[model samples]
Target: MIILASASPRRQELLSLICDDFSVEPADIDETIENEIELEKMPEYLAVKKAKHIQGNKHFDDIVIGCDTGVFLDGIMLGKPSSESNAAEMLRNLSGRKHKVITGCALLYKDRCISFSQTTEVEFFELTDMEIEDYIATGEPMDKAGAYGIQGKGTALVKGIVGDFYNVVGLPVAMLNKKLKEIISNAEKKL
Candidate 1:
């Protein structure tokens, strides 16, 4: 059986494109990023933690996937907003600038694990305060990293993207599909 360790609907939806048969098992773990973790490695660190947390004894024979995404602007990570005002501030900071969206993914089975991170460069149009306020009013940015959902109403905020569009949505479907294929192939070979 294949299991996904995430509560984000976007990740679940993206995973479905790779495999139709799977279960959602959101991992329960502390998500706080420690000061010692490099900003670029934060996603992968959290992702491994989540996947490991879900891959306990019961799921020893099953494959578990965990993913963590973050938006980085000028070296600082902009996580999910704490409030509507914080969302606005995030949007303002991203205005007319290029930022990176990185999603770290880990796949675990038994004692084996595979992990990788995908980065997408997204540029936003110069946003006015009114536009930021309006987008925040839609309430789509509250739960999304960087206070924007590139796949939803927030699409209007993006000017262009240089990498996998799906990566910005929370998962890199193509890369994930490739990784899943490798794991399944090796497992079958062992059998």
Candidate 2:
């Protein structure tokens, strides 16, 4: 059995593409980044933390997957927007420039854990304030990292992507499939 250690509907939706038998077991992990931690390490670190939190529980022996995603613009990490204006600001900052979407995934079962990070470079068309404001008005950008959802209406703002599109959507499906197969193989070996 597989368990997902996250509350994100996006992560749940992405995981559903892989298997339908899995269960959701959202973990309560600390999301605060360490003051000394580098920006690039945030996703992996958080992913591990979330996975460990779930693995620490004694009730379940299933493989648990945890993931964290963030959007980086000019070296700053943009989380979910706090308000419509903030979402507008995030969209404006991403306008006509390339930004990175980083998502880290972790798989854990018992004491063994594996983690990997995927980075996707996304280019955005130059967006006017009206466009940004209009996007914010839809209420879609408020809950997404970098104030955009590549798989939804937010696609209108993106010009192109240079890496895995699934990563921008919240999971790196190709890399995840490879890693998940390896983990399952190892677990079978132990059995």
Question: Which candidate leads the pack in lDDT?
Answer: 1
Candidate 2 versus the native: TM-score?
Answer: 0.95
Q: After superposition on all CA atoms, how large is the RMSD of candidate 2? A: 1.2
Put down candidate 1 lDDT per residue, 1-191, tens digits, no spaces.
99999999999988988898999999989998898999989999999999998888378789999999999998899999999999999999999999999999999988889999999999999999999999999999999999999999999999999999999999999999999998888888888
lDDT by residue for model 2 over 40-153, one digit each (tens)? 879988998888888778524778898999999888999999988888888888999999999999998776788999999999999998898888888899889899999999
What CA RMSD would you report for each candidate? 1.0, 1.2
lDDT for each candidate structure? 0.93, 0.88
Which residue runs does candidate 1 get wrong by more than 4 Å? none
Q: What ranges in model 2 sit over 4 Å off?
A: none
Return the TM-score for candidate 1, rounded to 2 decimals.
Answer: 0.97
- What are the clashing pairs of model 1? none
